[model samples]
Target: MILGYSVTDLVGFFAKGLDQVINVVIMFIFAIIFFGIMNDSGLFKPLVKRLILMTRGNVVIVCAMTALIGTIAQLDGAGAVTFLLSIPALLPLYKALNMNKYLLILLLALSAAIMNMVLGEVQWLV
Candidate 1:
């Protein structure tokens, strides 16, 4: 009798955990669909392309601009969005300069961390 009760309790706990995972998966799917629609609509592409064009032929300026982008991304309330925008631009520069990919990634992470700390203060105000 005790064994049967224990098994039923475990099943109940597992079902609850599974339900939470399902909820999270559903939310993620919806977010991806929304982001995909925006991307397909060319809403963010033009701005990104313009920034790429403006930074051409200036390596230092491009690096600074990327850091600035990372900083601004913090303000927009999503670190992943900032990372997605910056990494693509950084990869080409890293390859051309023969820079260590890990180091570049580390610097990018550090910049994001600093920006997040600054932005956290803004959150307190809200």
Candidate 2:
């Protein structure tokens, strides 16, 4: 009765989209678990630490490396997943180096957006 959709009608509509909904839910769960394992196993810490050492604590180098990491992270064309994966890995480094958290997020967002566009991630398939 509300918005021309009775309860049964709404149920039917939801049933129609159930598979797509389930797939997204599963994807999110898997992404979270995968990233969790990486974080738990200390997979990314060394990389970030090395990058910090290589950059010699220069803000510019750190930001550029962060962007590069974000760009590589987006290669799979999933922005949310990229952010979920990159942010945790880089967050500690940003804090340790005393860099601005805003800058870290900004660089990641910008690089991911630009790389996604360049990689035709948003292009419709024929």
Candidate 3:
């Protein structure tokens, strides 16, 4: 009766949400693997190395650098790729500074949010 119909509708909605989540996860995994492969190919090492050298052991500067990278990555419409690439570089600086791990995490989240909001229009133009 009514109860059966409601249950069916709830189940259908749950299934659709699950499917969307699965698709998103699969897409993320593929993007990560592709970015990782590119990094491993030495395509990005020169750029990353130059950045590391430029930072010169400064934690605040390193954090800002990662934030900039994250923003650029978002502008390129690939947050995951930016995160995957920037994190390894940032971690050593974070450790060296004895900074709280959560600070970097929070900065990343804020940077992504700001990038998405500010860059959304710019992305559409390109």
Error of 1 at 33 (Å): 16
lDDT of 3 by residue, 64-97 (tens): 8667767776666566656665565565456555
TM-score of each: 0.51, 0.65, 0.60
Ranking by TM-score: 2, 3, 1
lDDT of 1 by residue, 1-126 (tens): 455668778989899999868965675677667666776686666555565577664657766665676777656766666666666556555555555677556666777899777778877889
**The candidate that achieves the highest lDDT relative to the unseen native structure:** 2
lDDT of 2: 0.83
44-65 in candidate 2: lDDT tens per residue?
7887789778888898877888
Residue 43 error, candidate 1, Å? 18
Q: Name the best candidate (by TM-score).
A: 2
Residue 90 Cα positional deviation in candidate 2, in Å, after optimal superposition? 0.9
